[model samples]
Target chain A: MSSLIRVRPTKIELIRLKRRRELARKVYRILRERLTILVNEFMTRIRRAYHIRKEINRDILDVYNEAAYLLGLYGGSIYEYYDSTAVENSKVVIGFENIMGVKSYTAMMKKGKFINTYPELNEFRERSIMLISRIIELGRIEQSIKTLGVEINKTKRRVNALEYIFIPRLTSTIKYLQMKFEEREREEKARLKRVKSMLEKHRG
Target chain B: MGVRDAYFEDLVTRVLTRELRIVNRHLPYKRVSLCDLEKMDIPYIVLRDGTAHLIDPRELEYLTNLLGKDKCKLLLPIIIEARQSLGEGTYIVRDRVAKRVIAEILGVEYEEEKPLIIYRPHLYKIREVLPTTTTIIFSPT
Candidate 1:
C-alpha cells in the first residue's frame, strides 16, 4: 500500500492572515478620509490664490494709470526733471506710513524727490510706478504660497490613495491567498489523521 | 527587487491581467514571456538590459511607430537596439505588444527573469525614460 502524505496549514498562520486583512481594511479607510480632506483644502487655496492675483493686478494697474496722469502734467520726464535742491528738504523715508498698505518707502522717497524737483503736473508718476512694483512683488509672494499649498495637497492625496486603495487591495488579496493556504493545510491534516487511524487498526 | 519595484511589478501584473481594472483601461496583457512580463495584471514588461524602464504604454507605441514598419516587422532587434542604447539593469516594458512586435521584427532573443523590488526614488527616476512624444497619462486610482 502507498504511504499517505498530507499537507496542512498551522492554526497560527490562519489567525495571522485574518489579522492582516483587518489591518489593511482599517488603513484603507483612514487614507480615504484623509485624502478627501486634503483635496478639499487644495481646491480652496487655489481659488483664493486666483482671486488675490486678480485683485493685485487690478490695483497695480489703477495706481500706475493715476501716476501716469499726474506725470503728464510735468512733461513726462519725471526722473530728469526732479528738483536736486529739494534733496536737502526731502526726508529719507523708510516706510509708507502715509499710504495705507503700501510698503517699500525707500523707492517711494526717490520717486517723490524726483517729482517735487521736476515741478511738472505729472511729477508723482515715478512714485506711482514704484508703488505698483511693490504691489506686484506682494502678488508674487501670494502666488508662491498658493502654489505650495496646491502641491502639498496633491502629495497628500497621492499618499492617501496608496494607503487606502492600493495597499488595502493588495492586503486583501494576500489575506485571501493566506486563507486558501490555511484551508488547504487543514484538509491535508484531516486526511493524514484518517490515514493514521486506518494504519493503527490494521496493525492492531 | 526592492519594495517599490515589487509594488510596480504587482501593479503591472494587475494592469496586464485586468486585475487593476480602474487604472489605464486601454492597456491589455498579450501573449508574452511570463518572467519578462513579471506580474500578470500590470501594464509593463521587464527589459532584459534593465537600467531605465517605460511605464507609459502610449510611449511604447509612439517609439515603435517612429521606427517604421520595416524596423517594427520583427520587434526584437529594435528592442535590442533600444536596450543597448538604454543601458543597465531591469526596466519595465510598459507596452508589451509593441515591445514584442519590435523584438520579433529585430530577431533578438528574449528571456524571462524573476521579479525584483524597485525601491523609492528609483520609481520616480524611471519616469524619465518615458517618450516625450506622447502625452503623459496619470492614473489617479
Candidate 2:
C-alpha cells in the first residue's frame, strides 16, 4: 500500500500543499466535464448503432425473401453458372479520430467491383451486398462504442478520485501544516517574551 | 513535506496536467463569428469531439437572415442531443434559442418551452446546414 503523505510543520509546505489542492480541484473539474461529454458521445453512438440494427432488420428480411424467391424461380442450377452482378468487393475505411480525447473508429465506405449479371442473380447479389454493407456499418458502430465506453469509465474514475479522495486529503494536510506552524510561532514568541523579562530583571 | 509526499504531490500534479493537455489539444482551431466563417481562409473547426465539420457561408447568411441577425446572440448551430430518454437514432435540439433558426431550416414549428426531437435524416439536414456549429452531445436524461 502507498503510504500517506507525512506531516510537515512548515508554512512553506502548507502553501505548496494548498497549491496542489487547487490543481487537484481544477483537474477534477476538467475531468468531470470530459466525462459528461464522453458519456454523451457514447450514448449518441450507441443509439445510432441500435437504429442501424433496426434499419438492417427492416431491409434484411425483404432482401432474404427476395433471394429465396429468385432462387425458387431461377432454380438452384442458376447459382452454378451466373455472372457476378452483385458488388464484387466493398472497401471499408476505418478512421481513428479523437472523440472526447479517445481515439475511436469512424467508417467510410467505397463501393467496389460491381458487374452485370442475370436479372434474378443481380437482385440476389445486390441484396447480399446491401446486407454486407449494413453489417459492416454495424461493426463500425460497435467498435466505436466499445472504445468510447472504456474512455468514459476512465474519465469517471479519475474524476471521482480527485474529487472525493485527493482533494479532501490535501485540504486536511494543508490545514494541519498551517496549524502546526502557527502553534510553533506562538510558542517561540512566548519564550522570547519570557527571556526578555528575565534579562531586564537581571539588569535591575 | 517529506520527500515521499513531495514526490506524491508532484506525481498527482503531473498526471492532472497531462489529462488537461490531452483534452485541450483537440479544441476547435478557433471559434469564429458565423459571419466571418466563409470570408475566412479556413472555413472549418475541429470539434472537441474530433469531427472536422465544415461550415458553409451561404447557409450562415441564410440563417442570419432568418433569425434576424441581432436576436441570435450566439449565431446558430444544430446541437444534436443524445439522452437516455431519447430513442435510438434520435437527435434532439433542446436549446430554445436555436429553435427559431432550425425551424426555418426544417419548416417545423418552434415552441419556446419545448425541444425539437429529430431523426437521422433531419440530423443530416442540420449537419448540412451548420456543419461546424452543430454538434452531437449526450445529455443527462
Candidate 3:
C-alpha cells in the first residue's frame, strides 16, 4: 500500500517524511523559476524566427523568378552545369551560440569556388547561394526554439507533479501520523492515572 | 563561484565564444562604412541592419550608356526610399538588368524609361541575391 492510504509512522518516520517534503518544495521553486525564463526566451526566439521566415518567403519568389528569367534568356544547358558545381562538397559550419543561456545552432555555408564559364551565370549562381544560406540560418534558429519549447513543457510537468501529487500526499501522511502519535500519548497518560489511582484505593 | 569553479566554467563554455567570434560571417552580416566605400569601387555597402548595393561611378557610367547620361546621378550612396518615393519596403533600382531581374522575381510592374520601384519582397530578393550590392532602409512609421 502507498504511504498516503495505510502507513503508521513513528516519530523518526514523520521526521523523514517532513525532510522529503522540504526537499520537494525546494526543487519545485527552482524548476518554476527556470520554466519562467525558458518561456520568455522561447517567445523571443519564435518572434525572430517568424520575422525571418516572412522575409524569406517574401523575397525568395522574386529571386527565383529572376533566376528563371535569367536562365531562360541564356540557355537550359547552363542550369545543370551550374547546379552540379555551385554546391559540390560544400559543408555548412554549424556551432552553438547561447542566447540567454539556451544554446542554438549558428550556421554558415562554406562554398568551394566560383568556377563558372559565364559571367552572367555567376551573378545568378551567387544569388542562389545567398538565398539558400539565409534559409539555413533561419532553420537552425527555429529548430532550437522547438527544442527549448519541449524542455519548458517537461519542466512544467515536473513542477506540477511536485505541487499537486507528491507534496500533497506526503503532507497528508505526515498529518495522519502526527494525529495517531498524539492520540497514543493521551491514551498512555490516562492508563498511568488509572493504575496510580487503583494503588491509592487499595492502600486506603 | 570560487576561482577554481570559474576557471572550469571558462573551459566548458570557451568554444561557444570562439565560434561566435569566428563564424558569424552571414549570421548578422558584416557592415561596410561609407567613407571606405568611396575611395575605391565596390559592389555593396553594408548598413547596420542589411547590406546595400553600391552604384560605383563606373557602373553609373555604364548605366548612362544604356539610359543616357542625363538620367545618371553622378554621386555615390544613392538613397533608396520605401514609402514616399516607392511603395512600402522598397528600393528604387536604376540598372536595367538588375531592374529586370528584380521585376522578373517579384512579378511586379517595371518601366524601361523610369526607375523601377521595388517593394519589400523584391528588395528581399535583391538583398539575398546581391547582399553586398544592396542595403535596406525602413519607411518611417
Candidate 4:
C-alpha cells in the first residue's frame, strides 16, 4: 500500500495502470537490450581506438625519425621545396557516419598529386600521409565512444527508473484497486444479509 | 487521481514512445545499391531522418571484390534487425546477399534457407570491418 500510486479506486484506473505497467515492462526490456548493445559498441570502439593509437604511436616515431634525417640531409628549405612541387594539395572529405543511431564525423583522404621528388622524400611523404589517415580514424572513434557513453548512461537511467520505480508503483496501485473493489463487494453482501435478517425478524 | 497526476502518468509512457520512435531514425528510407553508390563522387544514402549518411569507398571496393558481378545486388548500409523476441544478444539479417556478406565477413556458416542469425560478438566484428556500411534497427516484435 505504501508503494501504491495515488489513483481513483475504479476499474478504469486499474485498467490504465495495468496498461501502463505493460508498456513500462516492454520499454524496459527493449531499453535494457539497447543498453547492452550500446555498451558493446563502446567497448568495440575503445578497443579499436587503442589499437589505432598504438599503431599511430609507432608510426609517428618512425615518421619523426625520417623527418629528422631528411632535415639533416636536405636542409630547412626541403619542406618548402616539397610543397612547391605539389600539383594538387592533399584533401580529406569529412562527413558524418551513423552507427546504430550514434553519429560521428568520419574522414576519407584524397591522395594529392605531386611532382616526383627524391625517392627518400617521396617515401617520407607516403608514410606521413598514412599516419594522418590513421589519426583521423582515431579521432572518429574517440568521438563515437563519447557519444555512445552518453547514450548508454541516459538509457541506463530510464531502464532503472522503470524497473525500480514506475513499474512497481503501477503494480501496487493496480493491486490496491483490486483489493478495494473486493472489500466493497464483501461489505455489500454482508449488509444485504443483515437487511434480510432484519426483515425476517420484523415479519416474525 | 487528480488531473495533474494522470497527466504525469501519461508523461512516462509518452517519453518511452518517443524514444522508440526515434530509435531507427538513422536508418535509410530506401537503401541504395553498392554499384550506384560507387558511381557517385561522394557516396552517401539518405536516412529516414532526412540526413545524409556517408559510405566509405574502401568498404564499397572490398564488398565489390567479394561480391564481384553481384555487387549491384548488395545494398548500401546493410541493415541488422535487433528483435527483443529473439532473446538478448541475438540479431537477424534478412537479405540474402547481406546475409552472405555478413557471414563471409564474420567467417560464420549460414544457410540460404534461413535468415542469417548472428550474436553480439559477430556484430562487433562485422561493425569493425564495415562500420559506416552497417546499421542496426530495433524491432519491437
Candidate 5:
C-alpha cells in the first residue's frame, strides 16, 4: 500500500527487485514498440479512409447526375430494367482483418452476374459497383481506425503507467532498500568501533 | 517480503510472460507464396494463435505484378522485424524478394541481396499498401 515495496533489506530481496525491474523494463520496451506500431497502423487507416471518403464524395454527384439523366430519359422503368438484368444479387464477403492484434471487420464486394444488355445501363452498373466497392473499403478502414484508436489508447495508458508510475516506483523502492542496507552497515561499523574503544579503555 | 509484494511480483511476472509469449502469435504457422495464395478460394494463413489471417487478393495481385515471374518466390504476410537493438523506429526486412517488393512499393532503393532497413514513415507506407499482407514482429533484444 505504501510507495515503497515492503521487503526486507536483504541481498535476496535486492536480487528479486532487480530481476523484477529488468522484466518490467523489457515489457515496457515491448509494449512501447507495440504502441508505436498500432498508432502507425491507426494513422495509416485514417489517411486511407479520408482519401476514400473524399473520392466517393467527389464522384457521388457525377454518378447521381448520370442516374438522374437516365431516369429522365427512360423514366422509372430504367430502374426496373437495371434491376431485371441481375442474374443474382451482389455478395459481400465479410471477415475479420487482424492488424497486429486489433481485429476489424472487413467486407469485400463480390461482383454479381448481370445480363450485360444495355450499354448505358452497363456503364452505370460498372460505375455504381466501383463506388460501392470503395464505400465498402472505406467502411472497413473506418472501422479499423476506430478499433486501432481504442487499442492505441489502451497501449498508451499501459506504457505511461510503466514509464511514470510502476517502473519508477520499483526503482525508488530498490534505491530505498539499497540505502537502508548501507545505513545499517554504517551503523554496525560505528557500534563496533565504540565497543572496541570501550574494551580498550577497560584494558588501559 | 510481505504477501502483497509477493503477489505483486508474481502478477508482474505473469503479465510480462504472457505479453512476451503472445507478441508474435499473430504470425503465420507457415507462410504461403503469392502464387499459392492466389490459387485459393479465400487466401488466408493460419496464425500461431489459431486464427485465419486473411490476405487480400488485391494485395496479392499487386505483388504479383510487382514481382512478375518471381511472385512464386515472394512469401505471404511479409514479416517486418522490429528489433529493439535496431534502435527506435527502424525495422528490418530480411527476405530478399520481400525486400525488393517492399522497396519497389515504397519507391525506395536497396542493395541487392541485403536486408532492407526501413524507417517509421517507410513502415507506414508499406502497411498502407499491404495492410493484410504484412505483419510486424517485435523482438526485444
Candidate 6:
C-alpha cells in the first residue's frame, strides 16, 4: 500500500489566493449591509400594515354597533332615515359632515362602490366593512412582501458566508499547499545543479 | 375576407392552435394514473406537461386569448384538465396556473376564490375524500 504525502504550496499560488480572498471579503461586506437595510424596511412595512389593520377592524365594529343602535331607534332600515327629506333636512349639517368624512377616507383608501358591493349592510355599515376589507388586503400584501424580503435576506447571508468564510479558507489552504510544492521543486533543482558541478570537478 | 378580417381570423387561428398545444401537452401528464405521480419531481411534471403549464401573472393576455372572453366559466375546466394530468400526488405550486388548477380540482364554488396566499410547509398531511375540500395544513416542522 502506498502512503499519500502532502505537497507544500508555491508563492505565486499564495498571492493569487490572497487576492481572491480580499475580493470575496469586500463583496460579503457590501451584501451584508444591503441585507440589513432591506430587512429594516420590510419590518417597518409589516408594522404599519398591522397597525392599519387593527384600526380598520376597530372602526368597523364601532360603525356596525352604532348603525344597529340607530336602526333600532328609527324602526326601519337606515336608508329610510337618510332618504326622508324631512329627516335629511333636520340632520343635514351633522349627517353630511359624517358622510363626508367616511367618503374621503374610503376614497383615500381607493375603495369605490362601498354601498353597492355590500348591499346586505346599511350604507354606513357597508362603508365600514369595505374600509376594513381594504385594510385586511393591505395587510395581506404587506405579509407577502415581508416574506419575500426575509427570503432575500437569508439568501444574502448565505452568499456572504460563502464569500467571506468558505471561499477564503479554501483559497488559503490551496495557496499554502502550492507554496510548499514550489519550494520543494526549487530546492531539488538547486541540488541537481550542485551535483552536476561536483561531477564535473571530479572528472577534471 | 378584407385585410383586417383576414388578420383577425389568422389571430384567432394562432390562438386556437396555442390553446390546443397547451391542452395536448398537459394531456399525457393528466392521463397518468393518479397513483403514479408521487415519484416524479416538479420539473419533470412541467416538462411533461409543457411550458404552458406555468402561468405568469404578467401573461394574462395570452391566457385570456387561449381561454376566451368567458374566463369565469372556462377557468375551472382548464384547471381540472391540468390537475388530472399531474396525477395523484402532492405538489407545491406558487404560479397562477397551479392555483387555478387546484381550485378546480377541489371544486371550490366561488369564481373569485383568490390564489392561496399562504401554504402550510408540510403539504403531505393534506387528505380529502372530495378533491375540492382539501385544506392544506402548515406545520413548521
lDDT of 5 at B133: 94
Structural similarity to truth (TM-score) of each candidate: 0.35, 0.62, 0.49, 0.92, 0.92, 0.37
Better of 3 and 5 by lDDT: 5
DockQ of candidate 6 against the true complex: 0.01
Residue-wise lDDT of candidate 2 within A1-204, one digit each (tens)?
A: 332357556667677777777767766765665576567667767887898899899999888788778778878866565544334566665555445346566554556676777776776777777788778768876887899888877788888888778887877777677777788889999999999999999999
lDDT of 2 by residue, B1-141 (tens): 568867876887889777656655544554555655645543455666556544444556666677664443544344556554564556677766576667778888867788887776666666545543565554334
Docking class of 3: incorrect
Instruction: Flag clash pairs in model 3.
Output: A62-B105, B44-B132, B51-B134, B51-B135, B52-B133, B52-B134, B52-B135, B53-B133, B53-B134
List, residue by residue over A24-143, the lDDT tens digit for candidate 3.
Answer: 665555455446546766776677788889888987987888778876887786677776765455567655543323444555566656566676677776776777877986887687
Q: Each candidate's DockQ score against the native complex?
A: 0.01, 0.16, 0.02, 0.72, 0.68, 0.01
Q: Would you list the clashing residue pairs of candidate 2? A: A40-B138
Interface RMSD (Cα, Å) for model 5: 1.3
Decoy 1 TM-score against native:
0.35
Which residues of candidate 3, in runs, are more than 4 Å off? A1-5, A77-89, A93-108, A111-126, B1-141
* Model 1 agreement with the true structure over B1-141: per-residue lDDT tens digits: 357745664453444334212222222223233223223223332222221122323444444464554333322211211111222222334444434433444354444342222222232233223311111121212
Candidate 6 docking band: incorrect
Q: Tens digit of lDDT per residue, candidate 4, span A136-163?
A: 8899889888888988888899889889
Residue A25's lDDT in candidate 3: 60
Instruction: Write one digit per residue (lDDT tens) for candidate 4, span B1-141.
Output: 789977877887798788778888889999999989999988999888877888888899899999988899988789999998898889999998999899889888999989999998888888878988998888877
C-alpha lDDT of all candidate models, in order? 0.39, 0.66, 0.56, 0.87, 0.87, 0.39
Best by DockQ: 4
Question: For the second chain of model 5, what is the TM-score against the true structure's chain B?
Answer: 0.96
For model 5, state the Cα shift of residue A162 in Å: 0.4
